[model samples]
Target chain A: MLHEPASQSGPDASADYKMRIGVWMFLLYAAIYAAFVAINLLKPLWMEKTVFLGLNLAVVFGFGLIVFALIEALIYNHMCGTHEADNKGGE
Target chain B: MAIAIFLTFVAAVLGLSFYFAAKTKSASGYFAAGGQIHWGVNGIAFAGDYLSAASFLGICGMIATAGYDGFLYSIGYLAGWIVALFVVAEPMKRLGKYTFTDALDAKFNSRGIKLFAAISTLVVSVFYLIPQMVGAGVLVEPLLGIPHYAGVIMVGAIVITIVATAGMTSTTYVQFIKGAMLVVFSLIVTVAVLVRGLSTEPDQGGRVPFYKYATLEAKEVKGALVVNDYKVLTSVPAKAETYVKLEKGGVQTWWLRSDKDGKIALKETQYEVKKADGSKLVNGLPASKDNVLRQNGGLEAIKGKTGPEAATGKVGPFEFLSILSDPETRINTWKIVKLSDGEDKVVVYAPSVKPGNKMMRPGLKFKTEGTPIQKLDFLSLMLALFLGTAALPHILIRYYTVPSPACARKSTIVAIAAIGFFYVLTMYMGLGAVINAALNPVTDNMSAPLLARTFGTFLFAVISAIAFATVLGTVSGLIIAASGAVAHDLMDRYLQLGHTEKQKVRAGKIAAFVVGIIAILLGILFQGMNVSFLVGLAFAVAASANLPSIIMILFWKKTTAKGIAASIVTGMVSAIGLIMFSPSMYDKFGLNPATAPVPLDNPGIISIPLSFLVLVAVSLLTQKKEASAA
Candidate 1:
């Protein structure tokens, strides 16, 4: 027989909403990351093209990904925190 | 001075550990910091825990040596944190009490889940710990002037004391301090690099300048010559390749012919040979202070510059990269070749000049024009890094330190911000090393610290100390995670040991000690081995073995305990097995790489999917039995 969970906590009212938003965002990021690998594989020389601010595509895209992730993480935290606060008040 | 700074860092870390030890009496406190860590502190600590020596030294060294290929690791590593935040962070906080195994077995609570998860945790932690320990040894040599084994033992002893004394509480604070210092210092280094800017002939500060090359007509070249009391044996092979082997009083070096309009132009190469008799030679001389390999690597020329003194001072971040990306700019990069000469192993370090535009792009190490297998290896490595961060036991357990899911999410954002900013700095630090004549051509791992030295010895000392702290913080986390797997999951939960809280804590301390010693031994044993590959292997294993089970358990209702257990074992075994038989390992074993059975060095593309398949198939097969039993 399976043992019970070690501690009992109340159900998270915001779990489903968070899950929906989180999965969608994860998929979006995954697609973008996949494109990075694909481009490096298919047309590696294209990374040399100066696409932004005189930096090559490689430097621009690589920096963009890191900055983009930070922004996405902050946005996710804000949305999740707000949703949690709303759910707690309603409950 | 570096030793003094390093000792001070160690003392502060120990003081913090002992301070926390007094308050950490219970299992909860020892294991999870009593779940009271502020989200902001926990967030920076997360960055500390995640950015191991591999991320700092290895990636920077890679960028310094290989250019754009090195940045790929930074991109993949940071991207993995997204998976952690968006998918794993909140759910993990809600489920786990002490360890990640607690979360995996939360719903089922099966002994099987506990056993496999604990084993997987231990394996991954140990695999990760070895590299950090080895890196500690490597850093200590330059910083503290100690032998490699002493450095490994020093780190092992300190980390063990920290984990044994206060466990996760001490580990978190160490990581937090380390994370903040690393980011701030890296930013400073980046600023210094920008201020120094691009120069064709960088001021080497009285150090050895770049080595010069010589050219001769093919017909003018004699079979042998004696220059400066050194015997030079020239060989002109049928394949139009010309090379010269130089020997001076039993010392050996090699120079390879370079392309110069069909002329026989020979580029100098520094070589170290270890004869079977155990004697060593450096650059055709005995291995000593005066016979050391000359430091090389700097801008051959900057775009639109007519003379060596031309400089681009105080360039902006974009302008720095832009100047480097210019077609006319050229920089020096080294290519390594290993050969055996009559039972003596010779490693030749040769420098090649490439256009800055080419170096700023992705083809140097990843081999965009290489074989299909090479491309697959690159893809697999990126995939593993992307999936591995969320699955690492050390990274996952940080969730339990936070009080709420919201804090966990908040802290994750903090970590991403701090870590992302540091990665950006790494690019500058790496490029700075390339153009500053700061590379230790033999050990690229010294790039960042050496770059610091180019500024001043004091900065070098401080950077090296923080780097050592970086290793200490990471090792403490890994050891604590491993101890948790042993004390909490394996001994207490899986075996039903029924130990009291104090006994469990004692058991954890003992486990930490044992793991620390084991890590130290392994670190010493593998002293001169390349550490980057070990880190890559750990990531591949973590992604392959742990991620599929994690994703399935959280998302799929049909994920039975049997499926989870099977998936974890399958993933772990398959990934490790593939790596062991991969081309790289074969080369390590002194066998021909082409003869290796596994085509791909990284097993993520195969083992990850294979693990998912095993979980699905096993879950389907066991679903009926599980339902009937319930």
Candidate 2:
């Protein structure tokens, strides 16, 4: 388990760092998701255009969202782990 | 043989539950699985729990019918999990002891918070439970040839046994197994769909052609509706009449029913046998003799080159999508239209041919050109789906089953990965059902399983059995959540019963039994509705009621106990109240739905924002102490 040792970084500082990382990641995802919805509402015709192989713009964008989510999760996990390790080492 | 396979799956799951019962002797184990479940198992269990019948059966059926419109829901649902992973998971695991109510009450320890949060949990769980039970009844009907009520009762009993015996331990294991099975089988079927490719030709052995029948006059006889002059017409104009073909004694006859008034409506048709004595016998074809499943037909090629125009044979996945986007592929889609009655009454599903390119776009199902109210309705549904997943009581409670905050976060990530992959596979499987002609005319929910049946009977049997298990897993989770709200949060803490651990466990088991019975009755009452629609209602409720309270508490320092309690009640009541007076509910009451006060079908676009406003208003009035401390 990843944790900040109490002797080094206090609980409040550790929680603050974790909260910032979580919030940033959430905002990044929300932006991408919101963009997809905006396209559907404002310019639905753009979704019908074929972008890759036989896949249309709507489909490619959807697939992009799923892939982006997985990537973001991995990045968040790794960053949070490294932050916890650095905090523990400071003791 | 299929029945045998189905029963075996049920028996094995039951035996697993009974075995786990021994380990759940303590209150903690019964409610939270002792917080000892491996993160990996719990991750897949989350997928299993979240991917109710709506995900597997409903989405596939929607795609099979409406094309890309159904896949939009997949994006919305998966996106909601991102909120859970980043915002809710770690804090939830750190704060709560067992149920979701425990998490919100962690700061204030107020009885009012506990009372309303528990009530919110129960209402949301019950709302979510009905769809799973209804989907269960639907699956049982086609698989076992039993009545719909019997299937609902069987699922209720099995899920109750699972919850009552081993509680969260058994529920977790069952979800893990079923979730893994659902993903793997969906992948296999999707690959099979790709390999088979697209075809324009109808089945060779059983080619049922179209015919038009003569109009029959209807007259009132003794206050009963009766029709006369039932005969098959040989010839009619091609464009303006309803056509049907009937086969008798290995001979096929074509009949045309004209569009003129008093024309015979082809409600249904069967064979009548004439004996030597000039008497006629009307009866059904025997199931044993006529049991072979038939392939769906009516798909035709609209845009094709001379070579591929004949048939694409076996195309690659990219090639398949490209071909479907071509304008020449005409698909027969079922459309429900209103008749002269003007109300939603006389709803009839008329078959219409749509070009492939149009089907690949959004306007086929959710009309964008309609009035602003219709557009708002679409946005409202999307908003609910995008926000609902994290707020669900059953999904929230799963965070407590893991050992640490890290485990909770890891499990959510794993769930997103697994769920995301399965949702992608659903698009292919749904489209496969469409081109393969696997739709049951009456109910679109049968699309995925029927597509599996086209491969082989054993695959069909396995898919059907797993779908039933899907219902059981989800329903059990919901019941556990509901029972936890009753025995742990409400009765023990709020009511000041202060029950012992042993007493709490006993009370929880009893609560599960009672909730399960209520779910069964509701399932039977709401038969024939599409499972996806019902699940949407549940999501709206969860998003409106629980989400505002959770987000406000986690971020807002000024949030008081009264604010949280008031928001929970306001969100729950407003969403449900709007639904009750909405047009859909009016239709359920056999009243003129157009006369309903609420125009929008989904209440989230209104209720969610209203909840936030109520929370802020209430908190400002009651925030003296909390504000001073901050």
Q: Cα lDDT for residue B272, model 2?
A: 31
The runs of at least 3 residues in candidate 1 whose Cα sits more than 4 Å from the true structure, single-residue gaps closed, are A1-10, B205-231, B234-242, B246-253, B304-306, B341-344
Docking class of 1: medium
CA deviation > 4 Å runs, candidate 2: A1-13, B202-298, B305-309, B336-349, B625-630
Q: Which 10 consecutive residues of model 1 chain B have the lowest summed lDDT? A: B212-221
B119-229, model 1: which lDDT tens digit per residue? 999999998987898888888886777889999999999999999999999999999999999999999999999988888777654454544444333323354443455
**Cα deviation in Å at residue B436, candidate 2?**
0.9
User: Candidate 2, residues B1-630: lDDT per residue as tens digits?
Assistant: 789999999999999999999878877889889888889999999999999998888888888888878887788889899889888888777778888888898888899999999999999999988888889999999899998999999999999999999999999999999999999999988888887777665331123332221233433448433444433322223345433434445443333333347444443322233344544333223224253223343366636532235555667767776677667777766544332221211223445667877777666666644677877887888889988998999999898888877778889889999999999988888888877777776678888898888787888899998899899999999999999999988888789786777898999999999999999999999887778878888999999999998888899988898898889999999999999999888988888889999998889999999898999999999888666765
TM-score of chain A of each: 0.86, 0.81
- Indicate the residue-level lDDT of B622 in model 1: 99
> Candidate 1 vs. truth: CA RMSD?
2.5
Q: What is the lDDT of every predicted structure here?
A: 0.86, 0.80
User: Model 1: which residue pairs collide?
Assistant: none
